[model samples]
Target chain A: MTGASPADTAVQGTVAQPEWQQLDRRSIWVAPVQPLAGLLLAGLVAITFRGWDRFGVIEPAIGAAVAIGVFALSAWHWRTTRYRITPTHVEMTSGMLVRKHRSVARDRLRSVDLTSDVVHRLAGLSVVAIGTGRQGGESDDELKLDSVTTEEAERLRRLLLDRGSRAPAVAVADPGGPAEPAPLARFEASWVKLAPLSIMGLVALAVLAGGAAQLARSVGGDEIWRSGPVRGAWDWVVATPILTVVIGGLVGLLVLNAVLSTVLYVLFYGGYTLVRADDGTLRISYGLLTQRSVSIEERRIRGVRMDEPLMLQLGRGARLRVVAAGLGTKDGEGKEKKDSDMLLPTAPAAVAHRVTADVLGTPTSPVGAPMRRHPVAALRILLLQGVSLALVPAAVLLMLALVGLVPHWIWQVLLLLVVPAVVGAWLEYRNLGHARVGEFLVAQGGPAGRHTVAVRTDGIIAWQFRRTVFQRRPRVLTAIAAVAAGKGTQTIKYALQDDVLPVARDCVPGLLDPFLEPDHP
Target chain B: MRLRPPNNPVHPRATTWWRLQDAGFYLVVLVVAAGALFWVSTAWLVGVVAVIVVVGAVDIVVTPPIRYRKHRWEVTDQAVYVRTGFFVEDWRVAPLSRVQTVDTKRGPLQQWLGLSTVTITTASTAGELKIKGLERGFAAELVEQLTAATEATPGDAT
Candidate 1:
């Protein structure tokens, strides 16, 4: 391990690379493949040329011309863009007609992520996206350095966030001392089984199976059904008894979803690894094809979230996520969701707690903390919502049945479902709970998922309190703790007036001073 | 049916602000009702309009005072506390450190009445907290104090 003075390194860096460093030549190749829409458009054109009646047979020369044109245009775009890096800031100069010069200070830089798609991987290049810790509507704060060499991408990740100097790029001391990063956590084989248990998986399977059936009926013709494997499965379905077939199909679909989701999980997170960098940053790299590396600064992470999906909850499985800012949360980018604040995919309950404790630097598990329950008003509201919603159909059917306009069975069916509706609402009210654990506030609730989010109180930026008309009678209101990180707001619905104030006081202490009269929520 | 709120309420002059806004609303409604007066077949539409106008007139006259009483706010060294709404009251407390922007807006009607709306923005998902119908001078003072407080607090580590 070498500890080079960052100041000395900066002086040496200017002589070698004067102002800017040019990207790899392979970027020109990647440029054409960058916009996914272009590829999709090309596919559409090819399909229409072959299948559409009006298009008829397309000449091969026209196809080649379009391909060459797109590639040439992309190359020209690549030629125009340039960038410069100093110890303090990274400056970018892009665009030909409308010039764009974006400069980001090294200290202000939030997170550096490297991503590679099928095209980028094939070309041995990666796209780097650097984000600033700014909220939405501040889009210009991010820098997208596309199609850099894989090695350069790695170097940039370390250098841009070096904090010390541009020349002494790597950290001075190798604390871990391992030739490779010691894997803090890895996806267990059992995580695949969780895919089947989730409602989303079941719903997706149903949709897929329905689509296949529809496709078989309308498009592909009898030859598709005669295919060897599908034929065997179809024959078995037909041979079984009607009741057996119905039950077996459901079970089969669940199994298929489990296997499918597991395969999907493995493909995305097969070599999943969370490594602690020498500088205390947690660097995560994963995915089978579209390799991605995400770096989160130690201080940026506020807390952890534990989600127990209903199906997975039964089996003691949970998913873990980090509560942090500067992780892309807006809906526009598909990359954000893929590489966002994910700490772990599905894992056992114990493992989830262990990882959370490790991340927060706590000796005890994050789970099993005592929580404060909502007032009875919450239950009343839930029951009102559930019963009133369920009764509307029942009343309509009953009225129609009295006039002999509808069958009596309709009313009976509606009546039969009412109990379950009320029970579901009650369960939701029962789940609503909030607690203050040391410097963290745990907001937990939900009928199905039972989401438990533990956020550091210091990370909370504001508090919003609500007092509804119905809740007034029971002296209860809702409190929303807004943080700059993650989903942004944590809610504690139907809290008593006495309870919420203390919670607010605990979260922000002197933020809501005693000078102000006791507020509603 | 009202929820018990904090002691410090909005400016007493806010009733004038509410009444002015209510009058403007009623003016629009009256214009439409007058136009409809000629087209009704059985005069039932006119009857309904008369009933609505009467109820609205009562609401405009009686509700402002209730609203003024319900609305509350207080500024401490570290945060801004506000409770508003005559029916569904909402209370908000935002730390000075989290304060991103602060502004005071005065609409034409409010300008005539010497009143302004104070808006406090934080990095929270709940959006902005606004205390409407404060004395113009008080609102300005609030903006200045809040801005100073925000600047004094250190950078958010997040």
Candidate 2:
């Protein structure tokens, strides 16, 4: 019923009707793991709350029923799922009852991703997803294949992304270049040294601590507090000098955070590689256990953002992410989404610039170019804002102290925080800069770590200038370059109107001309 | 250096429309505050009601004309320019080549005032540029002009 038209067949060349392919048989084994794990976790929670001695056959019987149901559904899904790649479109038909058919035009294909979690990896299967750059309803836009052989996944990625310009054609297209070039970037083992600088370890630690706390609560909170080692530690903590104990705890936490972050870094980016294939596609593949590879047409990349956390900046490290249309923001999309645009994981700043330069096809990275600093009035405004923010807590604490509800030193300490706030605002002002280099508009700003984004001037669709009443006195405004990719807006926050107007005019010639008035002498 | 305001002003009825909208919002607030009088002291209720009424009156009276003056829009062959907001003024410009869609919307309030809002959208996630409260006929013309201009240009709008 869902057959191709004559035009589709013509576009496909000799193949009139391509044979529909089945998912790898191993997917049935892989699919049940998720549902079974969920059930198992529920059972474990129940057992923990009820006590192990109360464990009965009822739970096992329900677990068995769920396991069988999930297994049968998985087998049915495997049996019914079928997909085919014609010259014009990649099509998939799947469903036990609803019979859903999804197809994406070949020309509109924006990305092809292959991700394998631990279960799929163990089963030697990969989930392939093809994106066509449609906005809204992320799941509906992509054609997802639950599980396929790794080899088949790679073949599909190559075939879809590198259709017109294969390796030989690319060599012919650029006679000066080699047939196969080295990868643009690769993981360095020493990168783990910089892990402690990243907050990833602290984030993991927080998650682990939260989970452990929840689990302990479920298992009975009193039992843990009454336990021998915990009780002994509690007694020790009570007996120790307060300052000494606080310092020791901080030191231990730092050490633990360092170790955890390092392990997480290794697990997340163990074999990271960013390669621009001969056919002009950027391929990024990484991960230790649950491997993921994403291939995006290089032309789709509108810009790149180099992220430098305060600690990472101190270590002279940065992370690079591609600003592209198809890959949605990590948080904007729900969790379990494998759309990652990380061109280079946390690495040396120099390495990040080099990779960025290579990827953007510029002689030198635009982000490193000399930037025009924001007006000093911007610094003054930031200082005022930061000081005012700090004053709020100090004032509240002072009122509490006066009422004898809190210690006096607490408010004093809170007041002292103004110094750091001032310093932070100053750093942010120092980082406030924008530059137009070649065809890229680069903007860098942040309170702690700087984020320097270099957006392709042509990618910018519009310009927006915002000025609050407070900024009118300084003749300062925030200029946002609205592009279709990445976060979709690159902002030069708090710049003099004079500075940004000309920059905006030059960034995309004539777009802002209609709105700007003549400059006064 | 400052941006010259866009060339066209919205319909005069826009002020009345805005006043009605603000009045409706303040009415709801007044009702809520009056309800809360039963739960709290009369002094607190009076204070809350006074603040709300004062703000609402200011918003309804002082803001409408200022907003009407500030809100302007212009469309050239090359681009669409719009200026909006009173306290926090904003100027936006989108090239015709990058405009993906042009639409006109009219709420019940706007319909009563014979006003329509024309929205110009680009592929950018910065969102659409809306020139609110234009005469309905003029709004339609603006949408038609924008649609034609965007259609004539030949890019993916990305």
- Give the top-scoring candidate (DockQ): 2
lDDT of 1 at A312: 83
Model 1 ranges with Cα > 4 A deviation? A1-18, A31-55, A58-73, A138-141, A164-181, A199-252, A331-336, A390-420, A513-521, B1-8, B22-55, B156-158
Per-residue C-alpha lDDT of model 2 across residues A1-521, encoded as one tens digit per residue: 13333234334365557678888888998978976886688677667556778767876887798798889999999999999878777888999999988788887888888999899888788998787776534332677788898877776776677566343442244422475567888899888789888888888888878977887776677766776778899999999999999999999988988888888889988999888786778989899987988888888999999999888988999999999886654322344453467788889999999999999999999998999999999998999999999889989989999989999998888888899889999999989999999999999998878999999999889999998888898899899999888777999999989988998999888778767787573
Relative to the unseen true structure, what is the C-alpha lDDT of residue B139 in candidate 2, on a scale of 0 to 100? 89
Query: What would the TM-scores of all predictions be?
Result: 0.82, 0.90
Q: Model 2 residue B44 lDDT?
A: 66
Q: Pick the candidate with the highest TM-score.
A: 2
Q: Can you tell me which runs of candidate 2 are displaced by over 4 Å?
A: A1-15, A34-52, A96-99, A136-140, A165-180, A330-333, A336-339, A393-420, A519-521, B38-41
lDDT by residue for model 1 (A1-521), tens: 11223343477445444356566678877767655454455446344434544353454456567778887877776877777666567788888678888787777777788888888998889988887777656232577888788877776777766665445446553423556666678766767766556555566667877765665554344645566776898888788899999888778877877777766677777677787776657887788888888888777888888888877888888888888777665422433445467788777888888888888877765544878988887888888878888888989999999999999899888987779878888878877888888888888888746888888888888878787677777878787888887777888878776786677776787766553354434
How displaced is residue A59 in candidate 2, in Å?
A: 3.2
